[model samples]
Target: MTPRPFSGFEWLIAWRYLRARRSEGGVSVMTWISLIGIALAVFALIATLAVRSGFRSEFTGVILGANAHVTVYAQTYNDEFGRPTRAIRDFDGVAERLQAVEGVTRAAPMVRGQVMLAANGRNSGVEVFGQRPADVQTIPLLAEPERARGDIARLADGVAIGQGVARELNVGVGDKVTMISPNGVQGPFGTTPRISHFEVVYIFAVGRYDIDRTRLYMPLSEAQTFFNHQDTVDEIEVLVTRPDDVAAMIAPILDATGPDYFTWTWRDSSGGFLRALEMEDNIMFVILSILVLIATMNITSGLIMLVKNKGRDVGVLRTMGLSEGSILRVFFICGASIGVAGTIIGVVAGSLFAIYIDPVFGFVNWLLGGGVWDPSVRFLSALPAELRWEDVAKAVGLSLGLSFVVTIFPARRAARLDPVEALRYE
Candidate 1:
């Protein structure tokens, strides 16, 4: 007898077989294993992506807050440490020209230099930053009142110190500190290091190990005189209307300043940290995604078991002229259904878990008699879950795609079954 071609009804048969199996056996051990694997893989992918996104977002925010969106430094502008100097002089209204560029929100010249901070007989290398009093507030990471002084511009020798620097030097408000610049003065000594004293008006803590302990803030005029860089700034720190447009804004600044100036965005400045974050997320996602792959394997096994049990039906269908493609589709549909269902469940489950990780951690912290805002162990006192939609989309897509891929071989095997051989056993 000529076998019949498989039709839509054959898919119904496949589904019915799956349903019957579930009703009678209520998910075989293999099915359970597959389900667990898919669930775990989905969970891990979502969680890893969320964490990576969160950490990156948090760190980026901190960095941008402390730094500018784009920094334009002198090309030859070397420090007093005997390097070729970069010129950052009046580019004939270059700051205004940059501010006119599309996506540019604010542009300001920043004076920065290296200086030795001396307090209470202890001295440390510090980066002295000079900024406009009003514009300083616009930068991302600065805490309110960190520059507690009324106006840095008016204060001749007033300065601000980081908490870490203060603690180490045992200096505080009303204390006097002397800053020695690497740039020397050519007076009677014919090239002696320029040193100046300033009164510490306020102390601020940003909590960053690098910035908090090694930064000092002073007026631009004081810094210029201290460094002997008259009418020139080390760089121009720009604030953009949108962070993503940092690169777009850079071109104009670079063009206006000419090639002699080095223009860079925050991404350029924080590339190492960003790369590390991406690597961590990728490693975690790969590790977690394995769970899904394993689950898909289980699904494959279960479908194979179904094919063996339903050999008689398959034989009958084959005798009825079901094509190999139709047979393959039937089994593929069955296996894929299992994977799809598990992936859906996992996506929802993992997202909820990530969203509430902080609250859960808080409860645990409370139970352990630890303050939620403790600044000792964890870099951040509270838990933060930064979920990006793109990450979620990627996780779900990978899960679905893997599930589909795992079904292919099993489906092919089912399609290739010989009707006579299958029926002989039945």
Candidate 2:
């Protein structure tokens, strides 16, 4: 009797053919090679994309921590003070309205101005900013356990500076410094610059060299008096619960401030630098996909060899009434099994490797002698990696699809064989 149509006999034969020794028509060597090649390709593809994502995440976190997720500025048409710079009037109401918006965690008014920071005899131009005592502590990643945390509320008459600024000025905690304002009041003598002496209270170690070099923080009330804005603020700094949600939060904030005021997110301030990095990542993903494609090509070659070696067996099976479809299923299973196994191995290996790549790279570096990455030139001390599950799924799907497609040609070739022609020399 003919065999049942949906029986698993074809799968059993396919698996047996795969396990057969080289002397028995199995391409055993090629099978191992295909498995190994696919694993390397998957590992490389996943690890490469993960490292790029990690770098992007690191940059975004550092930038957002140092800056507000969004900033709002008011453009005043008329200012009683002739200073070219304008201030947002009635900012307390604006701050309250902003705090009420959904997703906005905090909204604080700040005064920002250019001031000269003077040490013993040396002076450096710096940007001075003023925040409320409670507000000052909210700056992102502003403090680290490596450095001692101090109370900004106690800094009633003191200034907080970045480490780079302190180094450049040769100042330290408790060292006295003078801040000079260029926009001074007109006195009986002439235009006199406003000078104020302050004790250094806290030092912010914000990792980024640029932020550390030029930012000085003080109380908002003191900043208003120094900048001559008694009842106004330079701008409103806003922090959202999620940095990624800044784009959506901009509209509601603008509604609260009316048309004259404008809002900008971190994306707006970051400009092309961040956008360019994203483009680079896309390019890398495309480039790495080629490696996986090349690896899948090995599956085609191995499957083709198996078909050629199994020609005599195919003729015998056909002569015994095994249909063309059954013959095709057997070979299809053989090829697909290899592809699935390799893809699974790749996903598991790639994920583990990317997650701990820094340590792996460190070991490799040690083996090859130190200085593989120069700290002076590279911003990150270690390689950062972030594996995305979607990426793994994409890689696996492409590999399996290619494997199944390659099987069709070889299986179809075997199905079309004439029993007499295939078994003539058997």
Candidate 3:
């Protein structure tokens, strides 16, 4: 009776061939080189994908957490004096209507202005956001207790400064900060710059260098007074339950706010940057896939050499009643075994590296004596690595697919070896 495919004898023969010593003209050294090459390639692919995923997540999180998902701006229209005015007069009513919209979590009216801050004999320019105390606490990143210093409760009575601003101005919570606005009072001669003092009621670090260095939060009432807007607001900041769904919510948002108001989503604000990131991600994957392809080529070379070295064995096996399919299975198993083992090793190593990236990065930074990554330049305080199962799966599929495909050519050559010629050479 014919035996089943991949029987114990076939496995035993494959194992014996793979375990052949270098002195016996075996391809042992080449096999090891191929294995290591595939492993390193896979590891690199996985690690890079993880870092890319993590950076995108962190970047988007910062954008959505600290800022509004959508902003509503009133159209510029002629006032009683025929001068164009862009301020929203009925901001409270507008905000209330926006809050009633489905998917909208909150709508807060705000005044935004550029101002120079002076304290401790240092001066720094910053963008000041005037928001209600209650609304200020609703910010996802700032509301974190560990990320914030001092009381948010005092935001109504004082201003909340960013960590970088506090550091630059050499001021802390409860310290007085002087703000000078360019849009000051209009006098007979010209407009004089408005200067005002506010206590730093809170300090926050959102892990973004640009925002941390140039943002200041003040009470809505105080901001209105400081900016010379008695009761009007510059815009209404809207937060949604799902920021990614902001696009679909735009029509409803416009319906609620009327035709005179225009809406800007976070995607509109950062679309270019996000698109660049996505493009980079695809390019990197393609580049690294080339690397994986090059690495898998080693398996082909190793198996070709193995087939050449085992020519005499193939002749003897055929004479002993072994079929061509059996010979093919034997060499196929040899190549596939190496591929499977290497892939497993690579996956384990890459996953561990991604999962413990923080400590590993810290160690490397320590060895380099610090400053391996700059938050000011990178916009994130730490190197991020987020291992996604789908990315990992894609990598595995690519590696194994290449390995199996390359092994086929060499396995077929071994199976088709002319027993007469092989035995005559032996």
- Identify the leading candidate in terms of TM-score: 3
Model 2: per-residue Cα lDDT over 1-426, one tens digit each:
766653688888998988988999998788888888888888887888788888887678777877889999987566655655558888999999999999898899999999999998888888988988788777756644124334455567698887767878998888999999978887898888999999988887655556667888999999999988888898999999888768888889999878888987888988577899889988987787788778877877887899899999999999998999888888888878888898889889889988888789989999999889753354554567888888788778877887788778887887888889998987
Can you tell me which runs of candidate 2 are displaced by over 4 Å? 1-8, 76-78, 81-83, 114-127, 143-157, 162-200, 204-214, 225-231, 242-245, 271-274, 365-382
What lDDT tens digits, residue by residue, belong to model 3 across residues 366-418?
Answer: 99999999988987878888999999999999999999998999999999999
Model 1 misplacement above 4 A: 1-27, 73-94, 100-103, 118-124, 143-157, 161-208, 242-251, 254-268, 271-291, 312-330, 360-384, 415-426
> For candidate 1, what is the TM-score?
0.72
Q: Where does candidate 3 stray beyond 4 Å?
A: none
lDDT of 1 by residue, 25-129 (tens): 334556667777788778877887887777677677667677888887766655567777764778337778777777777777778878888989998888888
Per-candidate local distance difference test: 0.74, 0.82, 0.91
In order of TM-score, best first, we have 3, 2, 1
Please tell me which predicted candidate would have the highest lDDT against the true structure: 3
| For model 3, the run of ten residues with the poorest summed lDDT | 140-149
Which clashing pairs does model 3 show?
A: none
- lDDT of model 3 at position 126: 96
**Model 1: number of clashes?**
13
